[model samples]
Target: MSCPFAQSPRSTPNRIPKRSSSERDSIYEVIDAAPLCHVGFTQQEQPFVIPTLHARSGDTLLFHGSTQSRLLQAIASGRPICCVFTLLDGIVAARSAMHHSMNYRSVVAFGTGRLLEDEALRQQAFRLTTEKLLPGRWETCRQPNEAEAKATAIAALMIEEATLKQRSGGPNDIESDLSGPFWAGVLPIQTVIGKPIPADDLPPGVEIPSRIASLTTSG
Candidate 1:
């Protein structure tokens, strides 16, 4: 089947010329690698954005929060929302200051969210989100109690339209600018998981799980 995100007007490129990504894999990769996303919505003609943890399931993206949150409440009522995920990979230094920029992967998605009301579906959403943030965590951690589950709100945004824009590699300088004395190169960056820190109240003799232990600077 054709990709649902392909060529939607909201997902089309309008800036940076060729930076708009056409490959669906690139879009999914960006979303999969990001732990947080900025969700934007409108209320009374005013715009607001909030950062929240998200997980992608097929063409849909899911996130949760306290049911009392204004943004979550609005989304639960079928409000249209714009979500953005970004990963900055490095700094590109160029001969000209105007041409200097950063290497990054970014995606913009548009959709209307709905509350997952069924208890079974809500538990599944919770499991998926927990595991996405920290692999294998859902199985190891305590499942939410009835009170906790009732207090939380889970919403899914069916990503009807989205776009992935990214830039990488070294500085792109013209022949004229190449002869300049200014230094031009890319300063690479990465996201690393440091040694796990345990809570002060944790009981002794407990060890880190294999999944959490596997995270590192390279991967």
Candidate 2:
């Protein structure tokens, strides 16, 4: 199905509208690929934007943090929230300086948060957030205890409206600059998983999990 978010002045891009989309799959793709997102909210007439990990459970986005955290408290109060996810793909090198740009995929979502009071639902959010960071990680690590669970808070945001904006391929340069002396091409960027290092206190004979090892090869 197409995106449920209708085009509004706030959600729509005023410039280069061709690069913007409101498609459901496109929006989800960007959100799922991003490792983290910035959540913006206003409290006491002051605005704040905090970066935090997030996960998608169907159309609802999940955020978790310490229950005592100011950001989490603000979010759980049912305040308006704006969440953004971004992935930088490459640096576009154009013949002219003004034509230079970065290739990226980004999403802007509008929602209001609701605290997950039910223990079962909060536990599910924990699992989803963990798996979102590293597949199979939730099963590999020790589960949270009652005290740990109580200390953590999970906030659910039902996406009310959203938009996806993306740019790809080479730079857009003027015709005259195409034959310029400068080299123009994309400097590809990627997120690579490096060798995993064991903890200093890790006991002997302990080995890295297969799922963790696979990230280096897969990336």
Candidate 3:
């Protein structure tokens, strides 16, 4: 089933409305593809935007931090939150400076965070997060000990309303400037997984797991 996030004034895009979408698949795709998100909220009349790792679990988003983190504490207080996920695809160079733009997929979601108190759900979030960052990693690595688990805080945001905005392809230059002296094209951008480096103090003879090795191959 698709996400049920309804459109609201806060989730609507006034500028470049054509680029915005309410489609659940589109919104979910961007969220799942993004490795990190910026969560914005206001605490005590002061605005704060913090970037952190994130993972999507069904229609809800998961994030975690140190138990004492101010951002996590603010989020778990049920304050209004604006979480944004963005993926930059390329830089659009146009013949005219004003026409330059970037190709990207982004989502702006509105919700209020809630702490994941249940042990099972909290463990599930941790697994999903680890697998999201690196597939098959959770199974290969040692599970978090009780102390480690207790020191971390996990929260969920049940996306109440959200919108997806995206732009693709090359720059949109004016007709007169199409053939101008300046070049116009897209400088493609991508996130590449580089070769893995072993830890300096790691025991010798431990080979890289297939899951880690496959990243570079796929990248």
Task: Write one digit per residue (lDDT tens) for candidate 3, span 5-116.
Answer: 6997888888999999988888989998898899999878999999998988878989988999988898898988999999999999998888889999999999888899
Per-residue lDDT of model 2, residues 62-138, tens digit only? 99999888788887898888999999999999999898999999999988888999988999999999999998899
| lDDT (CA) per prediction | 0.85, 0.90, 0.90
lDDT of 1 by residue, 1-219 (tens): 355465666668878758886566778899999979999999999999999899888888888889888878777778789899999999999999888999999988888889889988888899999988988899788999999999999988888778888898988888899888999999998888877778999899998777777874433
TM-score for each of the candidates: 0.93, 0.96, 0.96
The order by descending TM-score is: 2, 3, 1
List clashing residue pairs in candidate 3.
Answer: none
- Following a full C-alpha superposition, what root-mean-square deviation does model 2 have from the true structure? 1.3
Comparing 1 with 3 on lDDT, the higher-scoring candidate is 3
Clashing residue pairs found in predicted model 2: none
lDDT of 3: 0.90
Question: Candidate 1 — number of clashing residue pairs?
Answer: 0
To one decimal, what is the Cα RMSD in angstroms of model 1 from the true structure?
A: 1.9
